[model samples]
Target: MGSDVDFVAYVCEQAGLGGALSYRKMFGEYALYLDERVVALVCDNMLFVKPTTAGRALLDTVEEAPPYPGAKPHWRMDDVLDDGERLGRLLVATAAALPRPKPKGPKVARPGAPRKR
Candidate 1:
């Protein structure tokens, strides 16, 4: 029920990163994605990032929690950002790690193909 477009934009803007980002409704919560791989989410006004193993190791030395209960937490860079450079680096890293998705095209039928009965 919440508008995530703005939230996602805000984060992307603040981080100075951009790409073909989009969103879809999932189980009543909004799931945000960069390219095709999920990147983050806005739940209850708190932003959470997808936990990549590499990203996990980055913060493993510190304690962290999932964005929401009963689910995995976003990459916690909140406490570590004493300046914009650190935050931007974290965002860019995650953005770069995201897998680029192949373009999905519309289904087509062969010529003279029989119609469904």
Candidate 2:
């Protein structure tokens, strides 16, 4: 079953990272971002945080599971949802440990559009 919007909203609310926290719907699920870095995924009403040494160390207990089929295991964080402070800290640490996303190249001009002078 697809993830519910309410669940996604609850997860976001519980994370409590302010403006830096955002989520995008993907394939009927949700991807959680911290400072523009994808730190977790919410699928089937479950939260799957990307595995990082810092995140692992911060968690009270670790459980690994894939957010979707054919994906690498992540730190299943559903149990931590209730504690907003810990969740926020874990997300920040995960984002910090993850590398920055690559910069996108300029978009290609449309075939019918005029080229830059």
Candidate 3:
């Protein structure tokens, strides 16, 4: 089944990161990004945080699972739905550990364009 919009919103809201928090639809699921770094993924109404030492230390109980088929095991954080503070901290730490996203090159206009009268 496909993930619901409300679920995605709820996850982002709970993350509580002041830095640009955004999500994008991918393969009918959602990828949650904090400051351009992908922190978590919402698939089938479940939250999966990227596994990191800092993130793992913050969790009370660690549960490893894949966000989707053939994906690597991540830190499943289903219980964080109600804890915005914890969720926010987790996301922040996860984002900090992840490498910064590479800058996208500017798009160039096509040559031989029609001239305007």
Winning candidate number (TM-score): 2
**Reference-based TM-score of each model:** 0.55, 0.89, 0.85
Per-residue lDDT for 103 in model 2? 95
Choose 1 or 2, whichever is better by lDDT: 2
Q: Model 1, residue 3: what's the lDDT?
A: 43
Worst 10 residues of 3 by lDDT: 107-116
Best by lDDT: 2
Which ranking of candidates, highest TM-score first? Answer: 2, 3, 1
Model 3: CA > 4 A from native: 106-117
lDDT of each: 0.60, 0.91, 0.88
Runs of candidate 1 exceeding 4 Å displacement: 1-5, 25-28, 56-63, 80-85, 95-117
lDDT, candidate 1, 33-92, per-residue tens = 665667776665455666666555545454456766787656544564345455456545
lDDT of 3 at 27: 93
